[model samples]
Target: MTQAIPTPQAAINAVAEATQQTPRKITIAMAQYSQLPIGRPFGCFANSVRHIAHETGAEGRTPQLIAFPEMHLFGTPGMTDDERHTMERSAATDLHDELSDNFAALAKELGVWLIPGTVCEKNPGGYVFNTMPVYAPDGTLAAAYRKICPWRPYEQYTPGTSLTTVDLPGFGRLGLTICYDAWFPEISRNLAWMGADLIINLVRTTTPDRAQELVLARANAIANQTFVLSLNAPEPEGYGSSLLVSPEGDVIAAMEGATPGLLIRTIDLGATRRTQEHGTLGLNRIWHQFHPEDLPVPLPLYGGRIDPQSWHPRHTAITAT
Candidate 1:
């Protein structure tokens, strides 16, 4: 039940009014960066971001939107014990003022919408949440989405309580979900149902199941009939096949290696409308036929009257007086 922020709509209207004629095509860039040290996450990340802007800006082709990978402020997945200790303290201390303002300034300076992926957002009580904040070209805070599914024992960050979407000028509505959130199909479907034209997966994958995740990405695009952008970190632990899948489940562009590089592509926004009108396997039609009120949620039907104590016999025995 994440509430829609008023800023996105206001920004969308402002852009639309300013640009007059709606843009049919948009350029998007994904920066697949080598992981930086935890001690200097902000400075290192800013440099990598500038690399993308420089490469594209020099070509006289500044992207409308730029995407970065998840949990950037905390470094990558495999950090040393000292690194982790340093990251934890830094996150709890300067996350709000320093890290946030730096990214905002970057977007404003470059004049491009930037998704500087997940920040280790710290709360007043010393608790942290994995959050992604979207900055508009004018350095305005457009929208932010917290990671709904934090990778369990490996990442003990707080789970998000809601789903949120942001509206771009002519890009239609944009949805944000971080790494582990890609594994849950329901969340993507929900975003699509809510009218998200592009669903961006800001990921930090470090597992051997990269192939499986690739399939899942295509499946998500096909099912939702929306463009899917899977941006991954280029860490040694990261599987750097960052991809952009179209509504028809086509891989538009994919990074070749775990090297520092940029995946730049111009996509026809009009294609999203055309492809979704007649979805693959008629999914769009099928989606409209179901009503939430009609669905039934029944209790566990297996006549389960067993005592709670019977479930964990070994644990009970171990703790017995």
Candidate 2:
């Protein structure tokens, strides 16, 4: 039988204290996903997670944590509401249900923490929300975070109101945020303020301006002085820039667009602490230098009124349903 993993609170305190002494090396696994069927997606995710864990171990490094991209098990991007709902239901995995249990079993078997990036959750409101579930090595549920922000035309989906952070046995406080949430600086900054040492962003973004958004993500890490693990979807809708950024804004590991593979990296918590204590590189300097009031105001381009029916080509011949 496998040993039981410690609870989240206990793990957090232990890892936080460990950071003051020796630098604990934690492995972050990023899995990229392509548009595929439900079974294929789950299989691909499972293989990638297991492979990365084994490969890192073979490299003489024990992987303490593995993370996958947003909606890795279930494919995203359906055209209509009915289609989307059907896909979501077909691909949805219950948190304490069978699918979650499968991942829990994987964590137990591998003895590694698993952050299954974001899964499509069936909410009570007859809508689906993107959620992230963290599992302990002993196959226990550690934490779950729902995406606070949903993308455009996704108003039909329920919005999440809470942010969550959990502790891993070998890793420090881990924060969870989904794709669209990364676009909101307040979310990450608040997590940092709440004592999160690492922020995991699971994304499936297909926008043309994603590269620019990555710059913002790096800024969040630099400004917060915390490690960031961002995993992106591989293809068909996502421009994969899956990456790991250090507290000082260094791109430690980055994968190019739509690449289906695992990107593994070791994070040193002590280094992050030292950088903060020195008051030269991390949050200390940012606190001393930047002020919110000093920021420039965003100018309004077009009027507040938006007539989608008049401007949108898709709505040109549409009638209200």
Candidate 3:
């Protein structure tokens, strides 16, 4: 028989209790892959999650969190309106129902929190949003964060408006952000202000920008004085540079390229606290120390008449003749 999902509040409590105690060691799993058949990715994702946890646990290290890349379910672009609608209606099974249950069950069974990165979520607006849902160890939903900014060519997705964080019992406060959102510094600052000690960046990106972005992740961690777990998908869909950066901007664990596997490492939350306490001078420095206002804005590349198609095709042909 299956078990019931816990209320959001209960899930919050479960996480809060887990973080409050000591020893502060946690393992994060990042699964990298390309686009697969519709709904086929979930099976692979589940297997990867289970395998990573088992391997880490075998090493006597319990995985407190497991994270995947953005839009792990719906694959990449190519859905028509009708197909999108179908996906929206069947979201429970296709997107969350089974995955949530499995992760919750796994979290309960393995005693670890699962951050399944961002999934394709159908909102009431008839558009899908990239959203991340966090599961506590007790088979409960702790928190969910939708991507605030959608990348180019994905203007169809609805943007999220709120910034939220969840308290994890043994991990301190946790914040979630997906792919493109990491490029925006304000989002990370806001989460830090909200008391987030650990931020999980779930991404699916391509090269030749992968190495550069990995550096950015480390910079964000050092600036925020918090732990950053950047979980990315494998190529050709994404450049796999899954990394765990410490509060002082040290790369604790990382994996490069489209290799299908997991990178397990121990993170000491106490070190984060220590960095924040003793490194206040470095941490408190303003980001834009240089006067950005001194730079002038560039002119527009093109300026043309508003109505370019006003001339009829027949008239243009007659003029040419």
Q: Please name the candidate that would achieve the greatest lDDT relative to the true structure.
A: 1
- Estimate every model's Cα lDDT from 0 to 1: 0.72, 0.70, 0.66
Q: Give the per-residue lDDT of model 2 (tens digit) for 1-321.
A: 996756656654554554576555676666665655465645565776777777763246757788777776665455576786677776776587878988898899888888776777875566677789989999998888878998867534578899788865444677788887888887987787665778888887777767876897788888777788778877675888888888777898888867676766777754555444443232144433433344443335533432322221110111111
lDDT tens per residue, model 3, 252-306: 8788666655676766665555455445333233323324334443335434322
TM-score of each: 0.77, 0.77, 0.72
Across 1-321, the per-residue lDDT of candidate 1 in tens digits comes to 996544645644543443333345668888787655556756677777776776653235668788878865566356665667556656543335866788889999888889977777777766677888999988888987888999887777779878878877755677788988999987997787666778899988888777788898999998777889988887574888899998778898898767667877877654554455534432343343434445443336544433333211110111101
Query: What RMSD, rounded to one decimal, does every model reach?
Result: 14.0, 14.8, 18.2
Q: Which stretches of candidate 2 lie over 4 Å from their true place?
A: 1-21, 39-44, 57-59, 76-81, 125-127, 282-284, 287-321
TM-score of 3: 0.72
Displacement of residue 178 (Cα, Å) in model 1 is 0.7
Q: Which parts of model 1 have CA positions greater than 4 angstroms off?
A: 1-23, 41-43, 57-60, 76-86, 93-95, 281-284, 290-321
Clashing pairs in 1: none
